[model samples]
Target chain A: MTVLVFLDPRHPEGRIADAAAPALLATDLGATRGDGVFESMLAVGGQPRKMGAHLDRLAASAHTLELDSPDRGAWERAVATALSEHLLRAGTGEAVVKLLLTRGAEGSDAPTAWVSVSPVPAGARERSSQGLAVVLLDRGYDSTLAERAPWLLLGAKTLSYAVNMAALRYAKANGADDAIFTSSDGKVLEGPTSTVILAVEEDGVKTLLTPELESGILPGTTQRALFDAAEAAGWALGYGPLEPVHLMEADAVWLVSSIRLLAPVTSIDGTPISSSPALTEELTALLHEAL
Target chain B: MTVLVFLDPRHPEGRIADAAAPALLATDLGATRGDGVFESMLAVGGQPRKMGAHLDRLAASAHTLELDSPDRGAWERAVATALSEHLLRAGTGEAVVKLLLTRGAEGSDAPTAWVSVSPVPAGARERSSQGLAVVLLDRGYDSTLAERAPWLLLGAKTLSYAVNMAALRYAKANGADDAIFTSSDGKVLEGPTSTVILAVEEDGVKTLLTPELESGILPGTTQRALFDAAEAAGWALGYGPLEPVHLMEADAVWLVSSIRLLAPVTSIDGTPISSSPALTEELTALLHEAL
Candidate 1:
């Protein structure tokens, strides 16, 4: 079951809509041209987490697409409406709160903004605990292309995700559970739907490393929160124009996202890789505390 | 006014739905991930044009996405239902018939397939006659990347067209009417929503040229039909690994697509280019006869 709320100017607190019923016009550009932006965050105990980061990214995405956005307050109220409904009916163990805004029906300038709250998929949590067998896939863009080609919308989390979904399908078909995307120039970028993080220890100093933001990967909110938490716990942090070799040489690698939180990678392209359970437990605890 | 007919197994003719009302689930993958395929064809005198080519391409797109498509018969019936309704209300003027197939709502195997019929945008025909001022934009992939990376879905006409739409927006923002995409390696690619065609005449013999299929552009149904008619009319035809220089040097250049037909290019990047009214008239006649 899911709950939906629409950000309507006439309804300052949002208009709760029936999710089981049809809720989008067939001509909505979001369904037609994929002309939209979205954010998905985790909700615990009826409260959304890292909403500031998600909303910031959503605004940036809307700006990139040149779509008008409902102000942050409208989104906050709508999300609250949806989450409160979710808790009422589902008693939220954990829910996925999705904020979606689309350039409305074709030929219309009004943007359609909505909030949807649903239970987190069971498979996501299962994979989080069971770990993932991963493969590296080419994202077909040179890292430097982002700076030169803003029209590509590389930094925006737009609704145009067919290639991302295709990459994940390709990975699953190849016997891998997930994929890490590499830039055409051979730099480690991010995963199909998450950020790639690697940990290392040298001279008894621990460090967390993620691909540099310049590589055109979506800045992971969960990853950002965990990095801050790790820093406070006295762990060093690094960003990279990282290569696959760094991942292969690291003490451990993980894919982190809002809902999945952190999923350790146990293998790469069928080759066994080190998985640090202790590090996973430590980071998971840290992430929980941060949330 | 618009008409929508959904292809459902229980309804051999289609399930007609109100286009004015909400008709798609918010969680539909087409709305969220753009995980789908679509074809847009023109309707003349209430009959869809080039439907065979469009349906073939739609099936190919569905296959590439690993989506289960409703059979050709189902699509045919749904399109008929939509067109019949369109003719009733719109009086058989030119219309656009769009076939859409989505991966359905999340966690569901069902595919959402529908046909929408609406009057053709007046601007499409106006621009076809006025010609377009086009700007070139980088598509951010090497020309050769298509074959090596099936995950890019380069050849498939999927619904994830945000980049394509953005390129057009960029062109319009920069004072051009439309955009022509160029690969990272400087090879001339297709236009944002159409295919590029150039004409060269020497010694009274005419040759039609377009970028080769291997460049991973969507195969243009109008371009293909025009090529067949032109070949039958004794014009030479050529496939190209074309560069921007080829477009500049050609006697005439046009962008061709199903709904907009053939639209000539008057200038590229603000530089006046050659345009041949005689060739445009002759080709337009041929395209009409072919259709």
Candidate 2:
């Protein structure tokens, strides 16, 4: 497995290879202490999707943990450089690029980084079509969401992904394809590894929504744009304490993210629904606009 | 600024440095995920106190995480080596040695292992004498504490010290020395950075109780032995829900750990306690028997 790396852009020292997967050293600071940050992006048609938004979120997450990050431009160039090299070879594959940054192998305060690419999840395409059956795991939301003051969540993504991954495993163990979390108080929150549930109201007058910045949910760049497009199209939008029951009653439920544009929900806790296809198509179109 | 690292007794390459710090890089399979286990012990008078017990607890934690540890003989040698080196230096300065083992840091599935030591907090002596104040913070009781059926938490001491440090910072900013986290239901749980609260009963019984393991509290090794000693000495021992009112009504409170045997809690959330010399003396004796 070839992994490339860069620090403040530049090769982050001679250790970074052009396109080879370099062996990464995970130190106490990185693995044992979970002192780091990570970002996963979908590389579509040889280009990094939503690069700026991802970088912005990364910076914010880094700031949250007092972790360091490569400067924006340099990091950007480094990524672009790698992507270009792969493209120059005329090789293309739907890829998942992960940027992982930690406090370093010595357990010191200095930031360590690694970049690696893997084949996009084999099930992703199929999952998008079949959609996800999700349960409320109650881990991710309970960790830090309840205390966040909306709007501030646009921060960089830190490395405390144990809970996130656990949520996914929990869902699988519980007979569900995936999991979503709600606030401890029970307002529908986000997927175990994705964004919130959104759908259009039955009457088609408004695009009922999940709370934005105020929800303390990670600001999904793709989801945010979709909502904006809804408004531009004159579809009224809302954000609130969405009871899980409400999403089921709505015309449609779409799980939005960077890779999968929208994964429709067939049921909520096993309750099936008959939502309007027109609404999903309309919202997805808006998602592109928002992007 | 010199740091000392003790290679795992299983030091993969059979390489162990005699001075300070290990030579190999930490691998990150589980450490990156905070998926490992660790134990901190106190080294005093050229000997590590309660070493067997600490090692026992560490083994239990590893079992909880399902991680493999080096053989006991290797562990003893590593500890013996590190302690002998420190003993030769002979300074009044206290030290903290942290042993971390996660999935390998080379990004291999086999966990990584690393250990290091640093000067202990300079004020430990002062705080032990004058006692320290505590602020109550809310780091909700982990939901899986009961059933003890693999809460990763049983093994997760590897990487999430950030939360512990953050709780400490919260206490400092709130005009207290450290933070004690209570359950969401207002039950007194352990501190975000330490274990249970202790107090002498008005009836003069030297009780050293702790919240039940089911109350989403980590089983504090120090507190466990104290309970046995308290009972052996004719003092009643109890455990279960720790309501805030119960904590506030006590005669004296103390926080126990591997490093700080029993730091008296003079005040909580800014409220002072009536110092109990009997409770202090008895608790100290119990701690001395074990640590």
Candidate 3:
């Protein structure tokens, strides 16, 4: 597929007219190398959901990679342009767009950024309704002091996604739709294919749980929005060192991401459970309003 | 680049025709998904030096990735065929070949395996004669434990080469030919572009040090061969948490790899250092005998 990208977000067209692939251009280093950072956003209609928060988190991710904050205005304009272009051409209200930041050739400090659009991947919606069957594997990451663990591309959506793909492959081979990663110590970690697994309690407490900061999972963008909604809706919200047994007994299970607002999970290890619609319903309403 | 490969080390082609590439009838998994392990060997003349050791390491790497290994006998024949084919066409002793192993599709594993050969990359010899300059960076990788890190496709020559290419780009942009990696704490690690470094202590202890098992650096085949040879030649070997300062002050430096035996370090971080012939002589002899 021919991808349209901004080699220099500062002057994106210069690259397009010159026919320079973002991956091939000198400044567009981080995107292809998975060097810099990235944020995947869900678009309902023409506007991106939670644009500001995603940008905020992207800044933190860049700092982790020791890169400068790419100009927010430039990024803002690029997204607006890409989305508007999408609307003008395809006219699809449902979309998923990705913003990728790469280290530039202007030395290690040069900031480079790009944005692209694509249709939502297949199976995300059905899985959201039916829930994903998952396997929990220990990714063996130490996420302690995660903010200061600059030696990792951890929180940042870097391009080095071989491990991530491998994790998904492992899940499929194990007869699961996706995987939930855990630590070596049997502590429940995030899913290999998604963010923290969320489950509600019988007392009407909406809990937002995933691996703690020490679990080496990429902090979730959509997960935070739901946590806020859970609180506003008068449900108790909390984070925990959730074990697999705890997840098995929860009121509902969902894999949160920008594209799939909350993909509720119905089974784990082939064990089926009842699905909770109220939690996913409230989460989506709050997310739409937040957007 | 059509080349021959041994299907199994023993068959040598009268048996398994799959040699490097599996039969087309076999389930196709590796090509699209990149789900397998591979090793690149530097074969000179008609023989692959350390071929047995290379195959052994390939199996070890496969085990780490949870992929099935090919029979030693079958693998050897496939490799021999690959070498013979390259020699038949190129008529050159100088060559580089790759061996690949993937889980076969017979069962639940992602299966496929094959081999490919190409001429040695150009300018390799010239670059070795006149050392390349280097810049250092953090791979978001702790150089410690990298040698055996679980998440690391480190020692395994997996399909993921994006980071390796980025390392080279980082070095070239810094006005150097390569980049050295370090721990997040600024402890010098391995070269982003190559293996850990080496030098001779003026006190006569032959030293070729890299980061420890915890440093997350891949153990180079050339480094291993050199160490064994150094030991046989009555020189002691050591590894290190080599700091940038320690390297700048070293009497000599060189990068080791199977294809490029020993490339000298002409300068580091912009400071010029005179090349040492004595160090190069010992390393060349060591690699030559091993290959």
- The model with the greatest lDDT is 1
- Give the number of the best model, judged by TM-score: 1
Better of 2 and 3 by lDDT: 3
By lDDT, the candidates rank as 1, 3, 2
Residues B1-291, candidate 3, lDDT per residue (tens digit)? 435342443454523232223232211223223345667677777777677777877887777677777677667766676777778778876776767654433224534455556677788777766787876666554444444335445555654444566457556755788767766567876665457556757675666666564565666776777778877877767777678777787777777677777788888788877568877886788678756
Quality class of the docking in candidate 2, CAPRI style? acceptable
**lDDT tens digits, residue span A152-232, model 2:** 122335555545555566567767777676665667767745777566654646765864554556777667677667778
Q: In model 3 chain A, which range of ten residues has the least summed lDDT?
A: A18-27
For residues A91-144, what per-residue lDDT tens digits would candidate 1 score against the true structure?
958999999999999878899999999999878777566889999988888998
lDDT of each: 0.92, 0.62, 0.63
Residue-level lDDT of model 1, residues B1-291, one tens digit each, is: 889999999999999999989999999999999999999999999888899999999999999999999999999999998899888888979999999999999878999999999998877677667889999999888889989888889999998989989998998899998999998899999998999999999999999999998998999999999999999999999998999999999999999998888899999999989999899999999999999
Better of 1 and 3 by lDDT: 1
- State the weakest 10-residue window (summed lDDT) of model 3 chain B: B24-33
